[model samples]
Target chain A: MRDRPATEARILEAAQAILIAAGPGGFGVNAVAREAGVDKQLIYRYYGGLDGLLEALGVRLAQWWQEKLMAGLPQTPVENYGELIELLALQLLHIVRSEPLALQSLLWELTGSESFVKSLSASRARAYGAWMAGVRGGLEPPEDVDAPAINALLIAAISQIALAGRQADTIIGLPTNDPATWDRLEKSLLRLVRGVYARP
Target chain B: MRDRPATEARILEAAQAILIAAGPGGFGVNAVAREAGVDKQLIYRYYGGLDGLLEALGVRLAQWWQEKLMAGLPQTPVENYGELIELLALQLLHIVRSEPLALQSLLWELTGSESFVKSLSASRARAYGAWMAGVRGGLEPPEDVDAPAINALLIAAISQIALAGRQADTIIGLPTNDPATWDRLEKSLLRLVRGVYARP
Candidate 1:
C-alpha cells in the first residue's frame, strides 16, 4: 500500500493541476484519480468527498500565500515609509508573477459561489489585516493617505492586469505580456505608491 | 407569420436576459428560445445561428456602453487635467454601479475561453482607445503621466472591486457592498488619480 501521507499529497497536487489546467469543470474525482494514479476511494476515505478535497486545497493555497508574503516582508522595520511602500509593491508584483495558479484561483474566486471561496476570502482578509496592522505600527502614514484603500487598489490592479494579460496581451495600450511592460508597470506602481504616501 | 424585425429584436432581448441572469452557461440557443417563447427554428432563421445571435448581443451591449459613457462625459472639456481625471474616475464608478449586467459580462469574459470573448475584448479596447483619443484632444496630459496605464489601472480596480463585492462583501477591510463605503471609495479614488497626475 502507498504511504498514506504521500498518497494524500499526490492527490491534492493532482487536484490543483486539474483546477489550474481545466478550471472547475474538469475537477472531478475520476480525473484527479487518473492524474494521481491513486484509487478514487482513497479520496473519499481521506478527504470525505470533492468539496472536502477542495477545502483542503484552499487551505493549502492560503498557507502557501501567507508563507510567501511573510518571506518577502522586511526583516526589520524601516525608517522611511516610502521605501517600505516600494518594497511592498515590488513584493506583491513578484508574488503575482511567480504564482500564476494562485492568481487564477483568486480570479476564479471572484466569480465562484462556493462556501469554500467565501471562507478563503475571509481568511485572506484577516491575514492581510494583521499584516497591515503590523506595518502601521512602525510607519507614519500621511494625513491624506488611507493605507488600506491604497493597498486594496494596488492588489486589485496587479491581480486584474496579470489575469487579463493572459488573453489580451495589450490593455488600454499597455503591453501586458511583455517583460519590458511589466518592468515599466512595476516602476510606475512604485512611484505612484510613494507619491501618495510622501509627506507634503 | 411574425414580423422578421420584431422577432429578431425579441430574440436578442431574450439572449441578453439569459446572459445577465444565468451568465454564459445559460445562454444557449435552447434556453433563449424557451425564454423568448419562440420556436427553436425561428432563432436559426432570424439570427442565422447561435454565433450570430451572440455577435448581435455583443454589438448591442457595446452600443449601450458607448451611449452611457457619452452621456456621462463633460459637455465642455475642462482646462485642468486634475478635474478631468476626477471626472473620468467618477464616470467610471457610475458605469460600474449602473451596469450590473455589463459587470457580470466582463467577469464572465475574464474566465471565458471562446473566440467571441477575444473579439469582444479587442473591440472594447478599440472603443476605449477612441474615447481616450477624444479626451486627449481637449486636455493636455501631464508629462509624467502614462494615460493608458493609468486608465488600465483604474478600470481594473473598479472592475475587480465590483465583481468581488458580489461574493465577498468586504475585501482588505473595505466594505464593498455598502453605499457609504462606495462613496468613501469614490472620493479616495479621485484623490489617487489627482495625486498621480498633479503637477509638481
Candidate 2:
C-alpha cells in the first residue's frame, strides 16, 4: 500500500525465489509474503492478488528473455548465417546454465494452467518467429533444409537439455554438468547448422 | 484381499487413469480406490501401497514403450543408418501421439522425486544407449557429424514436442495436432538425418 518501489521489487524477488525453490505449486501469496518479510495485506494492495502477481512476474521474465536474446543477436544484419546460428545456440545454452530461476519460470509456464502463462508463451513464440524472420532474411539457407523446422528443433533440443539437467546428470552418455560436454554440444550444433545451412 | 486377478487389473487401470487425468499429484490410494469403485483396502492388499502401485504402473508403461519401440525398429541389423534414424523418429512421434498416459508417466518421472521414477528413467536411458550403440555399429557417420550428439538432439526434440503438445497446439508455426504437420516433421527429420549421415 505504501508507494514504495523497493517493497515491490523485494516482493517480486521473493516470488521468483519461491518459484525456483518449489516450482509453480509453491508460489502462494503467503509463501511470497513470508519470503519477502512483508505484510500479506501489502501484497494484496500492491499486486492486487496472486494472479496479478504471477502475471507481473511473467511479464518481467519475458522481457528479460527478450532482452537477453536481443543482446546476443548480431547488431548489424547477420553476414554469416553459420556464425549467427552458433551465437544464438551458445546464448541459449548459457542462459540455461546460468539462470536457474529463469529456467524454472519457463518450466512453470510450460506446465502451468494460468492464462497469463499461455499468453506469455504465445508472446515468446511471436518474438521468436520475428527473430527467425529477420535472421532468415539476412542469409540464404540450403534448399534441402527447412530453416524454420531446423531452428525449432535446435531451440527445443537446447531447452529440453536445460530442463533435464535439473533432474538428471547425464543424457545418453553426455554429461549434463561437465564444461567439456557443453563445449562439445556447442561444436556439434555449430557443425550441424553449418552442414544444414551453409552453401558449399 | 480379493483373490480375483481382475481386481488387480482394475486397480492398475484406475491408477493409470488418475495419472493421465491429474498427473502424479492425484495418484493416491484413496483416489485410485474411488476411481476404480473399489474399497481402499483392495489397493493396499493388491498393490501394497501408493509407492508399490506407482512402481507397477512404471513397469507396465516401460514395458509398453519397449514393445512399441522394438516393434518399430528394424528387425535385422540396420543396413542404412539414415533409414534407421527415420524409423526411430517416427516411432517416437507415434508414441507421443497415441500414448498420452505414457507421456504423462514420463513427465511425472522427469518432475517427480520418487526413486522408482528415477530408476525407470535410468533404465530407459540405458536402453536408448544400447540401441544407439547398435545403430552406430551399423553405419559410418560423416567425420563432422557426432552420432551420439545427433541422437540426443533428436530424442530431446521429440520429447519436448510431445510435452509441448500437451500445453500448446502449435510450436514455432508447426501445428502439433495436425497429421500433416507431423508428416512434415517426419520428412524434415528424415532430411536432416540424411544430410548428417548420408555419404558425402
Question: Which numbered prediction scores highest in DockQ against the true structure?
Answer: 1
* lDDT tens digits by residue: candidate 2, B110-200: 5777778766776667766555565656476556677777777777777877777677767766777788777666666666666666643
CA deviation > 4 Å runs, candidate 2: A4-6, A75-77, A130-137, B4-6, B41-48, B75-78, B129-144, B177-179
Instruction: Give lDDT per model, in order.
Output: 0.75, 0.74
* Candidate 1 structure quality by residue, lDDT tens digits, B1-200: 45888888888999989888887655799999999889979988878898888878877877766766666667776767767667766877788777777676777568767667766776666766566556755677777776667767777777777777777878767887778777777766776777678854
TM-score of chain B of each: 0.89, 0.83
Q: How would the docking of model 2 be graded?
A: medium
True contacts kept of each: 0.41, 0.35
Query: Could you estimate the TM-score for every candidate?
Result: 0.90, 0.88
Candidate 1: give its CA RMSD in angstroms: 2.5
Candidate No. with top TM-score: 1
